[model samples]
Target: MQYIYAMMFALEEINNSSTLLPGVKLGHHIHDSCSLPAWALQAALSLVGGDMPSCNSAAKYEEEKGIGASKGDQPVPLIIGGCNSVTAQIVSRLLVPLSLPLVSYTASTPSLSDKQQFPNFFRTMASDVYQARAIAQLAIKFKWTWVGAVVANNDYGLMALKVFQEGIQRAGVCLAFVETLQRENIVSDARRAALAIQASTAKVILIVAWYTDVMELFLQLDKLNVTDRQFLASEAWSTSSDLRQSTFSHKVASGVLGVAIRSSTLPGFDTYIHNLNPLLRPNDHFLKEFWEKEFGCSPGIATASPFASLPPCNGTESLWAVNNLFTDTSQLRVTYNVYLAVYAAAHALHSLLFCPDVNSSPGHNITCSFTNQIKPIELMEQLSKVNVTTPQGEAFNFQGADITGKYDLVNWQSSPEGQVQLVLIGLVNGFDLHLNESAIQWSTGSSQVPVSICSEACPSGTRMATRKGEPICCFDCIPCADGEISNTTGSTQCVHCPSEFWSNAERTACIPRQLDFLSFNETLGITLTAVAVSGVTVTIAVFVVFLYYRQTPMVRANNSELSFLLLLSIKLCFLCSLVFIGRPSAWSCRFQQAAFGISFVLCVSCLQVKTIVVLAAFRSARPGAEALMRWFGPGQQRGSVCFFTSIQVSHYFDNLSFTPDSVHIQWLSEVYTYYISY
Candidate 1:
């Protein structure tokens, strides 16, 4: 299934950013969303001399937290989330008088964005009303005259259902019974629960319960065979793997109705996926080669997105500005969107403070770098209306109380081969955005080559290649188990595949860490030592092969691109076999096994490439001899690399640049100074 992964990205851009007035090394403090009370947050916004916190206090509070400088001199700006409406409502009230900003990624409650009451609230997603309208239209399309509402007892539920009711009425749908479900009753008797819901005369049941409850209700209905009514849902059901798995799920929802803004249909989504990692050059030469080899496709593999405007985190993008370290996150965009939302706050603070119209009273502390005071309305009024491209691509300009944006609809389709494929089913361009890519060949729901991540699962040691679920749809890479590390995503192997399993050439998998001694000690340690020793000896053997059979089919084949790759694979397998000699973990573990699989695949791939190359080369040689080649095979054939070690060593040892620090620093300096990187 297309995983709708969510998490947070923490950005620390404020640490290095400066205001119009200089000299203040920006100090920051953060609180777990888990326990941030209203009073504490209120205390956070009060500014008084010597009452606010200081950087010097960081060392003092290294282990313990520093209370607001008893006087609360510094006003702390906050960047919170709309994971739920209660917190958003609370933060909205707490922030209004403080002139502090509360930017929300999903606070679509409409009231928060009112500007009159909560003048400091900012939102990026469509409001519940907008979603309600979309759902209403979908309901009308199904000609659902009588629709039932099974809503949760939460703020999101209440408000969302209200809006949905209004929209449905506006769209000419009859008012079905509105059943409010309670959180406490989720585990209650299913028969009683079904009876309660059965009272709704509407044939279609649309539940606005919290995500967890919606799925649970389906299960309860399944257990009770409560399949008389048709099931309708929302984005909550879009990516749930279990929803479609229940026994009565399909029967209850065989023609279920729902509303969702298919992600792929959104403008810039495909491009964002193609260039997911903002850190990588969209058109890099070498990376393209490695990327294609690792994941079969090269789009959407960047470290951060241009849409995600946050501080770069040590070669990666930390989505939020927590007081200290921030983790990679993807909210709507796999939770990391939270970081993008936070980073937007930092950018706003920076922009407003630096705006020429911005004014700061004299006598402000040199330590207090003033964040320009602008009401949310004023800030929204002044900020550029043009769409700002962020790495996350989720943060968008406020659509003026109405969220109007394109959405993509796709479903995971399984082929006869049992391969799960994400197929684009429809595209709705509500806001009319012209995309820059060719992936979305159909706009109004047509089967085209839509953007997809081919389930090219990056192994365990390798975490997600992009933040858990950046638009790319592929798995990420992390360092493999048992130590060793790589600096990029979707690595070919884990470091140190252990003793029992021999590490493959790519290190993606490991073979049994056994020495082919033919006659030796049977102990594991001795076998491992033999394995490591064998690895060294094997490298020597490959070198010898180059020296002697340097011209044999096995060696001469290295001349052609495919043959060379095959040879490299064979040699790598041999070298990896030696890994058993160095180390081994327990048996049957995926780490070692994965390494072996990768190694074997690459080796065989080498052979395949060689076969194709040989066929091409021979066909070209036939030339126009009686024009047979013209009729069958004849052309100026061009072939590329084989990565054959013996031949590649010259390119690697002599020309491949290894000066990383200099290269990176120079690159960064160039981007800042000249607006470009060479």
Candidate 2:
């Protein structure tokens, strides 16, 4: 979103900066394209001019009009625009014949580079052809031998497809297939597309559509259970989430592979935009808000067409520099250096206008001022040769016959966790056409893995493999299991293991969990036996005390306790706790702990009641007046304690008796107990 702001800011700055060149001081006007494709066409044609005139017999005609007089029919002769590629084509065709200079700031379709057709047209950013070659070169470096292409049927798509095809052919790779999809076609088509590509045996497929389309295509790929294929995308892939996360994540999470020009993360980009627009904010919001407030809509590539030629270099930071340089410059900078195109054409026309050439009216000085003498198409050939250097230090010379400029390539692979590991494959000097043409292997490592990236020997357990007489594919390494992690990029060994599968944190290997031993061990099993015997002793001691005090009417009436209630309640709760602790099954492991907590709480409550009753009987003189305490008496509390103790004592045995399947009731009668009394 911020990208739009920087683009608008570039146009604003170029339109605002005054050129110190001593001539007509540059005055600037702005249009709000609203970033719409249709509006972009309007802004381009409107700013650069919709029509041009014939350059034939221009000299005698200029001489009759005096200084700067030829543009009398249409006074403003300079032009720049057609931010959309279609509009640029229209404007380029319109201006090419008469040689009116036209420049586009953002329309980067490869067709505009046609020297014969768009002789007068120029652009600051690279064309799609350059981007295509860069991506194809990246694919070659990855050792991919075959590729598929998915493109729209538009001019941008066609141009991108042509250049990509050329690049792949030049790399000695095969085109597996070419499929076309519409902007609106969804998963059904994507499924068919992937299936068809799979038939081609292509490892990587390139998409020329929007990122959302790419994401949808991949989601459908997952549904097809065909995630083995790789992917390559254009500059349009930057805003894509799948690509960004895939770089450092294991590929299994999402199958995606590609090379793309990510905008440079230089801090100066924001500063550049802020200097142009003081109320700095996010790129899109600022652009939409400012353009809407000023021009009743948001601004876009079309609105800035007049000054497209000023920002020569379209780097990550150049947008900001553009906005600051041409804010109020000379007429040339204001309209994509159209005046300079005039500056160059006026000089070229010197032979025709003033020199003793076959057509010239000799010694007649037609005013060099291009305000009117030059037609929009007259400068087409000459403008192509001009090198625009903005005050912000942005420079561009679009003389390259083929695409490909400065593009970085990174080799990527996926790991088990669904993360992509982007290994720095190597930086290719794509613009270095000399090395590539100098020899088939002139590059240090051809296009894929440059020989200069690394020279160290690969560690053991991994091997080096190359693809199709070119770049290395990957360092093949064996992966360790779930308990381990890899800390280094090329490490042969796995790192620390997590605790879920280990007795200790150290993860040499996994060990089996030990089942219950209390069922067989003498010390543990016998100790439990002794504890049960102690419970019996406690029961006997309480019963003896009850008999010793039988003469007391309080003791006789109170009764020691409800033996049946104690046995029934304790047995039921103890049985449930035993079922919980006996097995490690999911049901038992999670639910048993909760059941035990409730049972223990109840047991403790009963024990507490017994102690309280005992104390109340010892202290109170009027026992009946104490209500439940005096009326029911201290004996109830004591019996509650016995009830609780009985429950707690049985729990110890229950816990120790746990096994992998004690609650295996189907086998319980046959295996868990033998010669049962009950």
Candidate 3:
């Protein structure tokens, strides 16, 4: 009813203005659609080609004033009706073949944007495409990976649900369940939807439905006492006053986040509504019905009136005495849309009637040369190009058949009186949503945002392993593998560490591996060093004793020179072991192996010489053994020892070319044991 008044208000404002549509008056023929697509289509057909029924005051006034009285005359050049998407679609399809234009105030289905289907359709409201994107973005911004959905079983709800699913899927959000509500079977559907909401683990639910259907669903939800889940609403029922004032508002609508159509207060609309009286327009049945319903009185003079049993209306009943949705003009969203729709149609007509001629001379006055025979096709063309600035200083123009999307993010908050209030918390322009999260109030009466995810995020040191046959949000945390690390939470995979680096105990990060070497500070190094030093000292003492006894028969017979050489070699071997004890460097790594190998070889060569000399002495008692003694003399023994030792030294130093930055402890221990056995 307010929507009708809004259109009348805009039409009245336009007709009285001399600057626009000069010396021209626009008359309207109103029809009641009853929110039915069939009725809306019938009304549209009657306006275009059928007879104008004199059922309302506006039609009678047009008839008596001869504004468009001829039987063949097309009184309505354009239409501004069909509030819902289904109605708009039906009427537009009917009007398209006849070249009629329709400017809807609130029909916002995404399918209406198809120029091929709704070529002559223009709407003041933004399409559901933008609304779906805004809702999806809001969920993603808050990291609500898992959520439930409830949509009406109609074109509007189904289309919005489809688009929303696409958007959320792209962002990796998953739905726990999707429930559809049928207006025809609202009782059963709402019960099922409520049960789905109650049983689901999702803490948030997205509801895309009309006001009445949503109201029914909320009633069921209230009966079930489902108060823990937060609901995300579409523009259709987001700011509906009926829902706000419903009995279940506190139980089911608290902490509801919604994307509402952008709205502004329409100037003079409140006064226009207050000044309405059935007596002034007695032929208008809609006004009488509104008056009776609002004042709860019988305004009809007939005895068969439905409201005859109620109190009689005095025609002086003030509309301000009662507060209702009809008179409430605080947030004029759909009303403002109606106003824009009317103005757009008027502007398009003005452009068509007073079009400037391209062939006219410069500075010549453009004439307003238009008859009442205006074609709907020409008006549609002009409407496509019409750009109008609203009274609130906002400007908009049609991109194709729809305007750019802009929405207000509203949250249902409880006032001090326990009434649900739609609080402005953010704005969405196009696909971008600017939200004030701190201002949001959750269903739990906390300032914290609600959690809605299938699984908790994997912490650092772990990677996410998705559960089979489930959504990506449902996952398990697995510890990182050895030599791998996961630095951040919710990591999908672990990264292998670099060769020189190794994973920490927690597997959260990579760190340098410990350098392996036999250091002098450890117990093993001290024990080995003490033993090596003692062996060298004992060898030196034996060498000194042998040298002191060089003149004795025992010393001469035992080959003292060879023994001294072997002692020197044994000292070299013992000192080489020290090279392996400290932190290994390039020189120590090369010299340790070479020194051990050459010293051991030299000691073995000297022992061989001593053994041969002893055998030669023992064989001297046999005949012809003197020749063997000469061959195994002191000079020969020295030559043999020197030649073999030189060969071993050269071989050991020649092959020393390998170097390493660091060595593993296990590998170093194995190499040390092998060398000791050798």
Candidate with maximal TM-score: 3
Q: Largest lDDT belongs to which candidate?
A: 3
Q: Residues 1-678, candidate 1: write the lDDT tens digits.
A: 001111111232334334322332333333334323454344334421125445322211110011211112443334444345566678667656655556555555656657677666665455666555566665665456566677767677788888777776654465545666676677563344466656655556666655567766766776766666655555555444465544455444443434444442223222333333323444333233333433334344453333233322343332232221112212133233343444454444445444443255653323323333334444444332424445435445545433454444444344456433334545445633222223322212333322212344465446454445323333355545543433344555546644346544444556674444322345775675566567657756666667676666866555543444455555566555444343333331223333433455555445544455566656665645535433422122222222332343343334225343333343344336422211
lDDT of 2 by residue, 1-678 (tens): 233333333333433433312222222223445435465445445445533333211110100010121333333344434545666777667756566565554456877777777766665445776667777765676556566788765687788989877886765466666777665566666677767865655556677765556666666655555655455555555324454463222221233334444223322445544454312332333343343343333333333333333433222332333443223221111123222222333333332223233455553344344445545444444444445554445454556312234443434444467544443333334443211222221112233332212113334323333434433322344554445644444454665444334332333445554465344245665555566556655656665666677677866555345332343334445444344333366456434543544344454455456555566766667655467464555465565555656665565446544443443442344222322321
Worst 10 residues of 2 by lDDT: 57-66
Q: Which wins on TM-score, candidate 1 or candidate 3?
A: 3
Model 3: residues >4 Å from true position, as ranges?
Answer: 54-74, 169-172, 296-304, 308-315, 356-368, 518-582, 586-678
What TM-score, over all chains together, does every model reach?
Answer: 0.42, 0.42, 0.75
Runs off by more than 4 Å, candidate 1: 1-30, 34-76, 170-172, 188-193, 196-203, 227-229, 241-257, 261-336, 355-387, 391-395, 399-406, 410-424, 428-678
Off by over 4 Å in 2: 1-39, 48-84, 94-100, 106-109, 127-129, 167-172, 184-188, 197-201, 238-269, 275-374, 378-382, 388-395, 400-404, 410-678
Candidate 3 local lDDT, 64-108, one digit each (tens): 011121223335457877678888888889989987888888889
User: Higher-lDDT candidate among 1 and 2?
Assistant: 2
Model 3 weakest lDDT span, ten residues long: 60-69
TM-score of 1: 0.42
All candidates' lDDT scores? 0.46, 0.46, 0.80
